[model samples]
Target: MRFTRLAGLSGIGFVLLLLGGNLALVSAGFPTPSDAVGFDEVARLHADASDALRLTSALLPTAWLLATIFAAGVFAALWRHDRIRGDGWALVGLAGILMQCVAFAGVGAARLAVATTATHDPGTASHDLGAVAGLWGLHNALFGFNQIFLATALLGLSVSGRRAGLVGRWHAAVGLLGAALLFLAATTSPYGADGVNPLALFGLVGWLLWLVWIVGYSVVLIRGVEEEVPSALATP
Candidate 1:
């Protein structure tokens, strides 16, 4: 029970960290996916927002850690349920979350490299716009592909959770809708390699839905802790 409550708190913490990091990046002039810009422009942006970029990069690892814990908690909660048992959906969801952590690590590394290079090695960055652009492309690709993992997590968890009676219909619907949009976004990712594509709107909307679904899930976990305790004490 205590561990479940801790997991719930970790989920909330993960959401807060992600929200804060993104807001910081936006405030520091991080470009949106729809904003097409050249390598020189990319370098300039990174240089200008070096502090925010570095800070966000540093914070993301912790967020990912919390995400892993939350996923594990969810899996534990559903593992013994008859509907989830032998289905492996909980494991699938856990795998998806873990993969997202790996994919986003690459994204963060690319961003941090660009920021560091632009800030500390301006001369090199100026002479080699090609390399800088390559980094930016890598970042965009990773970001786009990362949505696939998010979709997978949503699908696996929402479906299994619903069957186990751990997720309400509305919550499951949100997850399914978010999953569809995110999967569509991933399919169109190649077109957005340059970081400018109208299809990116699917990703944007899906990401917002993902946030809402996670918050709802976190609340469920937190509330479950209260409900489980009374039943646990009465058993045997």
Candidate 2:
């Protein structure tokens, strides 16, 4: 019931999800939007994919859903102590995180569709494959939206945390830096998720750094201020 403990557990789950998802991706050879070339290639890949690949692909959305819950918990825990506009930042960040989760869920659904229906009737398979390809094409935008909002939320949290004396200025700085990187990486056409090739790399780096910040934030949340903070938020 403790907020900090919840956050810590959430953080741990997130890291585990990240590791597991990537491993699954590797095992499944699931083509990311950034890597796949066209519909035919995607169709072929899906047709050849094993059940493990399809099921593993479903993990992405589950992970993101956990992230959304974590974000809400974090915002609730921090809002109380945050007087210097931290509340607003936390709210915004929560929103961003939620939106990102939705986007990721969308991607996951597309992946699952292939995994679930890849072996159906040829006509169904063709339609599903095309859907997957279209989803992949839009992946950039969906993913970019997440990065942008996530960056905003992180920056807000960092600033608010620093102001509350819950975290150091340097900690906040890292978040800001990470957010900046994500913003650039999030640059994509509004109509689609398309963006510069190299930018995705930058975004990936930024996301990793932000995850590091979350680890620290989880620590802080677990070790909240002594008296005013609730036992649930303060205690591990």
* Candidate 1 lDDT by residue in tens digits, 91-141: 878888889999999989999887766676543545667668778888888
- The CA lDDT of each predicted structure is 0.82, 0.65
lDDT of 2 by residue, 9-111 (tens): 7866876787787677766765553463556555556667756665676577667766766676677666666374525766677777777777767656655
In lDDT terms, how accurate is model 2? Answer: 0.65
Report the error of model 1 at residue 185, Å: 0.7
**Backbone clashes in model 2, listed as residue pairs:** 2-232, 93-153, 140-193, 141-193
Q: State the TM-score for model 1.
A: 0.91
Worst 10 residues of 2 by lDDT: 227-236
TM-score of each: 0.91, 0.78
Point to the candidate with the largest lDDT.
1
Instruction: Give the best candidate by TM-score.
Output: 1
